[model samples]
Target: MIPARSGNIISTGSVCSYIGGGETHAYTCSKHAIVGLTKYAAVELGQFRIRVNCLSPYLLATPLANNFARLDHDGLENLANLNSNLKHVTLKAEDVANAALYLESDEGRHVSGHNLLIDGGFSIVYPSTCFSTQNKIENE
Candidate 1:
């Protein structure tokens, strides 16, 4: 995307840099690096018309669902429960695609160096697992 906006100033963000972990010295810090890089690029590229921004999506269902299903059934159940809220509507891949469409459309032309969170209200509630402190193993 940056290359496409070659003449424009650009920004990018990891978006979840603010999330921290338990007994981990720098879990949050590592994620936060995206913010710094984003700001740096924004400042450096402002001279150009190119703009930078990030589209951050959270907890979208993926193929890994089956693997999680294979884990202890309780683990899978726990994850399903974790992904819900009072209203409990998990996000779809289409949701994120729509976001990218909006970002790429004329509507987002002026938007730069912004972290667009497409989270289905999940990040605010389950930041730790939502951003993936745990990765599902590839076992069948």
Candidate 2:
């Protein structure tokens, strides 16, 4: 398909790819591997105008998502919302789909070799910072 008509590859990862977990070593490692594969694929395929990217979304209220989480639908939604920076809104399948849609669209033509995180800032921020009572150290 690359030679025929420039292509795009959008893969699904997880927030675990960017953040390490306590005991789920195997699952965490697997997701991280996807990132490596996505990057490698992107570099190799770029020459043929084939873009490759991955979408890493947090917990969503789906059977597949719930199975890994071991939580029911409401519990999954609650946990996701509670942890996300955008606490007002819960992550959804539609959100992940939209990200995929954008990545595959011409709008994202130059966005290869990237992991578009749908994690609602969970991986980027530190939990300690939010709860720390220590003195606020200003950057010099």
Candidate 3:
């Protein structure tokens, strides 16, 4: 990359990077660190035309998530969708892959130190308050 004077460094993160979820403290902290590293690296490497970014996706039905939630793929998907802000849509690995591809491609040439969230607006919605407010309005 140094020789080419251009490159992209994409790091994986989680929704925990922006908001605390059910994940362990260590897991959340590590995700936060990845975001920080992405920013710092982007600044340092910008002179070399190297871009650094992070992909922070919401919960997925991976083996790790399944183990943590003690639920199978279907069960986990159901749980995640229940709290998701987007209705009737589930996040898939392909979605994340597409985001990565965009970052690596020319379309994202000017994007750096960006924490691209692949969440279906999950991070922006606080489930407790959001659902409680909606329920109150519906009940009224």
| Leading candidate by lDDT | 3
Q: Taking the tens digit of each residue's C-alpha lDDT, what string does model 2 give over 27-108?
A: 7799999999999999999888899999998767899868866789998888777777876988878999999999998899
After superposing candidate 3 on the true structure, give the runs of residues whose Cα lies further than 4 Å from its correct spot: 127-140
CA shift at 70, candidate 2, in angstroms?
3.6
lDDT of candidates 1 onward, in order: 0.54, 0.79, 0.85
- 10 residues in a row with least lDDT, candidate 3: 127-136
As a whole number from 0 to 100, the lDDT of residue 50 in candidate 1 is 63
Number of the predicted model whose TM-score against the real structure is largest: 3
**TM, every model:** 0.60, 0.84, 0.88
- Model 3 lDDT tens row, 21-55: 43556777899999999999999999999999999
Model 2 lowest lDDT segment of ten: 131-140
The alpha-carbon deviation from the true structure for residue 111 of candidate 2, after best TM-score superposition, in angstroms, is 0.4
Q: Where in model 2 is the C-alpha error above 4 Å? A: 126-140
Give per-residue CA lDDT, model 1, range 22-140, as digits (tens).
11336456546666666567666755656666665543345575363455544544564576452555556686667667666788777767667765565577665652434333121
The C-alpha local distance difference test score for the whole of candidate 2 amounts to 0.79
